[model samples]
Target chain A: MLRLCSENIHSFFASESPDEHEPPMPRSLTSANMTGRAPGHTTGKERILTSAMLLFARTPYSDTSLRDIATAAGVDVAYVHRAFGSKAEIFRQALLTLGPLDDIAAGEPDGATMISRICDLAFLRNPNRVEDVRPLHLLIQSSLCGEARAIIAQFIDSSLALPLSRAFGHADAGKAHFALSLLSGFVTHRAVLGPADLLAIPEAVQQRMLQTALMNAMLDRSDPGIQGQIN
Target chain B: MLRLCSENIHSFFASESPDEHEPPMPRSLTSANMTGRAPGHTTGKERILTSAMLLFARTPYSDTSLRDIATAAGVDVAYVHRAFGSKAEIFRQALLTLGPLDDIAAGEPDGATMISRICDLAFLRNPNRVEDVRPLHLLIQSSLCGEARAIIAQFIDSSLALPLSRAFGHADAGKAHFALSLLSGFVTHRAVLGPADLLAIPEAVQQRMLQTALMNAMLDRSDPGIQGQIN
Candidate 1:
């Protein structure tokens, strides 16, 4: 409860940083290099977030812990609590470094561009971009716990939903909100759930379906019968 | 691990029951009414599941304990442990009483019937059917924990997904799987997450939008422009 109030209080002063409005830099440069410390050094919080991003990617939220984050970050566990409050708070901070929300579907005029941006986050098996997708991976992995879902919901509400809503340029935020919600569902369904036949589709065709389905979600006002549109 | 294998072994002997193929009854008739043991005299396991279903609906998985379930069901905690193995296993058992997979979006020839089946599950606040939606509520509530998600995924694969796939009568199960995936995402998005403006849209209009968008997910082959086709 204190954590929730404190965060609200801080954000009141933290004017939406100009950095957020700027297109996100390549993640590698953004995370460690731009800590504004000595180039080789990271703030203890940054290191903890970096370690957390990794450990969370590898395990479920239940299995990952402050001790694990501290061990990975080479910091004291007490310091992690003092600074971050709880695992969920650390997760929120980590979500901040996960590039721009616009990188996923916001600000894209077309489906092809949208897919290109997010392929790194959830769909593709790009080893180099694995870090970019860990937040999503962790979301899917931790989706079964109430607290984790609450934190994620809070993050989406306060952070992800509005930017995408604004980026969609709709007076009504419903389109972007529903679209992203649908996207998360598609990812969860395909990644962890069954009906193995979906995996059997040629990856290329599935990508087309994903693009088309999402576009439909955004513009749900479409006539229902006209089918077979691909970006 | 032992629980998993035991389940698999039992399912192998348990030929698909005729009860599965029959259309599901209303929620009131399905859960306690058809326990097959007796009308008012539910078995200890049934009572335990009954309590679990209610308790899990109210709290997250981590917060809902074996002791809580025992107290609610009027049984000893040891019985819950001995019978259910763990909280997750009990959850799995409770998921079974959640009517049928077809109750969501399956076997129906059109979108109108599809909506009716599931309006009871997650979309409506139909108080009489609150018990029916408990499985989805629990799935959403516990979605933040890895163990909980794993079990849900397992349950989805083993029980829910294929039935819907078969019901859709598609040689390709991708459509059904993807549709259900999209549905869960929508529910999670609108319910737990935000873009609160959506709630402002009259509920009746929201229902129509849901039906249209879900149909689109199942039929992603549509020309992107043919929009606004409501079921």
Candidate 2:
């Protein structure tokens, strides 16, 4: 029975059909660096990562299993274990395939430019035309978990908070933390909440709303109302 | 086999020990109004609703079964089916118990007052001591699903957007939407992401951060750069 299930999974991946069973391979996985080899040789690993990314994006880590990823990728459960070592490793590798976070870690960021870059990395469709790049979505959900949560917190502190603190010469990095909060809030809304309703509002108006929120959050303007009573 | 499983489920809920097996009865369920009578008279339905809420909060709809709720509530599967009619109805009723959305639909809202109310309804620890209210968490997860997503979206529109439009005297209710965005973001971060790490920051600093974000999002102050460009 297990062998039968494994074969079914393998066939599903090899066919690469845009079926209900498989999330079609994302464009990012097709890139040279992400796949790490020619498509002919790394097809199995590539397919597994693509499926892993899709599942992780929408589902919480605790609920997702190696078998589920393997089944989605059309491979055996053993194949998944052999390839990725563990579920955590699969998730971490999947996250790395999403666009770079280096810019957030170092250098000065312009308000408009930073907003555009963050939005693009988050909302831009992969080459396969899939929207809501799954790894970023998964990262938000992963924040609730253990090791993954620690990794994400560290990433935010090192990549975002520290850079913003240095960029504007503020002794405090609260602005960067707020900036992350704004970006995270926007993306979470965009992904989990169906964007169809938001689309009813004029696109320009909504974009301006986000831009304003991001700028305000990134700049350290204190409100007197919350000062002394905050603690 | 199924009967044996059902019996085991019944024992689990009936014992009602503070084991991981059961989500302790929420105060809302214990209330005279919500459960339809005194606790002794309506233990079965109340337990079912409590179990349903916890399951629905974390598990996806399709993934959650009547059997699971029955098991968690210490009732027979038939009892759950007979009492609730369908899984969807049980979910809807569970949502109703969270508290009224009438305030969001129509009223003059003070931002701080409204924020406090929302935080209470969403984050309040039930008598059972579960800090994360399952329904709110489930609502966030439900956004990725179908009918549940529609219900949540309508709730936001009726409860939040319309009222905020009236409160602020803006023909556009986008501010209310933004306010919901901020609140949702905060709650999700608080619930799914552990608060222990955040506690490392000074209490005043974190509270000030949320207050500032809420204020900026609720007030429709367009940035100068994005002003003319906004539709």
Candidate 3:
């Protein structure tokens, strides 16, 4: 059973053809180059984030320690501390590296457009950009437990709320927040609860349905009446 | 600062009169003298679940321990063990008590209705069913790690997929999995992620937008040729 499961997982990954849809990773940021500190001040920070992201993708946050992250990044513990004030800060920064909300905000034309763009950005960045999507899942699972909840809650609030409200004309902060909540929920669900076919359903179908639902939500929000009612 | 925050939290909880839309607990099953348990079966299991739910709601899963739950439930460790085989099992069963998906499934008219009903049910349950809503945020926060990821992933797969697929009538199991992922994401996001002001975008607005989007998606599935072609 284990062998079969392994073979199936291998086939699934093989079928995905990483090159086709995988987001580009900066050469400097790749796991392979994340080690051996450079003379630049922020290089160590970047390396730490890269290593942390990779490890985070594979392990739960509780299981991951600053020392472990430092080892993975080939940096000293002191260097890790200098770069990020704490584990929470490092994890937050690492998540930001996946794709910053600021970039999504900058691309939108209006509140409605912003919502669509944000959803698209989240979907695109999530499955593809993060090396393994698994660590993101682990982080969320950990949030269900301790001090991590506050950090996770704050990260989500800022990532989705601040920029989303800005795009929604500030007056419609409520609407923007609601929209953000919906979008994040969708993205997190996919990130954590997916690879659905092994236990539930196939992957392609799930993607299509999600894209459809998201597009629908976007189009509905575009209507002036709908936006007015929400505001 | 902590005291201030606690005071504010207390004020918020105290001021908010219980809304009519609270979720129905399996009170009929777990009430003090319910018929569900075998005679002489100590109500320790139910108490453990109650404590677990409360702690899991306030604290992240990792930070919460079996001992904490035992202490809160006012039961011996041995009682907890007799009731739940493990902490994960306790968490899982506690969440299940919030509402069974099967209960929702039994009430739907068809696949489309199933989605609508589930959404409505989740919305209604979210405010009332603190147990269900609490774990959602925690789970999302923890998804960044490993063992937690596995546990949550399995729960999503087992608990959400099959029932959602049956409701959707998608011939392909993969499609069903995707549908559930999308739904779960939407619900969780709505339940947690943002401030009440942001979330309070008027129920009418939410309903209209969600219904329109849902209908559009359904139509697209019913007639693939018109997919993306329609506004």
Number of the top-ranking candidate, with DockQ as the measure: 1
**Which wins on TM-score, candidate 2 or candidate 3?**
2
Count clashes in each candidate, considering only residues at least 3 apart in sequence or on different chains. 25, 3, 46
Q: What are the candidates' interface root-mean-square deviations?
A: 10.7, 9.9, 10.6
Which 10-residue span in candidate 2 chain B carries the lowest summed lDDT?
A: B1-10
lDDT of 2 by residue, B1-231 (tens): 000001111121223343433332233435533645754675788778878777765554545789999999999999999998988788777766553444332256655555444544433233243233444555654544454655666666665556555555564555666666766665555444333444456644655666666666666554554443322
In candidate 2, which residue pairs clash? A9-A74, A10-A74, B104-B159
CA error at residue B126 for candidate 2, angstroms: 5.2
Q: Write the per-residue lDDT of candidate 3 for residues B1-231, one digit (tens) a residue.
A: 000011111122223344544543333325432336774574767677767776655444555678899999899988888778888787667656643545456555465565555445434333224333433433443343343556666655555555666655654445455444444554555543336654576765665555444444333332232233322
Candidate 2 per-residue lDDT over residues A138-220, each given as its tens digit: 56655544546655665566555566555545645555665666667665665545434465666456666676666666664
lDDT per residue, candidate 3, A1-231, as tens digits? 000001111122234455655442232233333445553554767768867776655444555789999998898998898778899788776666654544455546564455445544443333233453432343343433233556666665666666666654565545544444445555555554445473353334444454455544433434343234223
The RMSD of every model to the true structure, in order and in angstroms, is: 10.9, 8.9, 8.5
Task: After superposing candidate 1 on the true structure, give the runs of residues whose Cα lies further than 4 Å from its correct spot.
Answer: A1-28, A31-48, A59-67, A75-92, A101-112, A124-135, A138-159, A225-231, B1-25, B28-49, B59-70, B75-93, B101-112, B124-134, B141-160, B224-231
Best by TM-score: 1
Candidate topping lDDT? 1
List, residue by residue over B1-231, the lDDT tens digit for candidate 1.
100000111121123343433323345534343456546777888888778877665455666789999999999999999998998788877776654453454335344455335433435231122343445666655544345666776666545455555544554456666666777777766664444666676655665666666566555546534222210
lDDT by residue (A4-50, candidate 1, tens digit) is 00011112112334233332224453534246676567688877877
Write the number of the candidate with greater DockQ, choosing between 2 and 3.
3
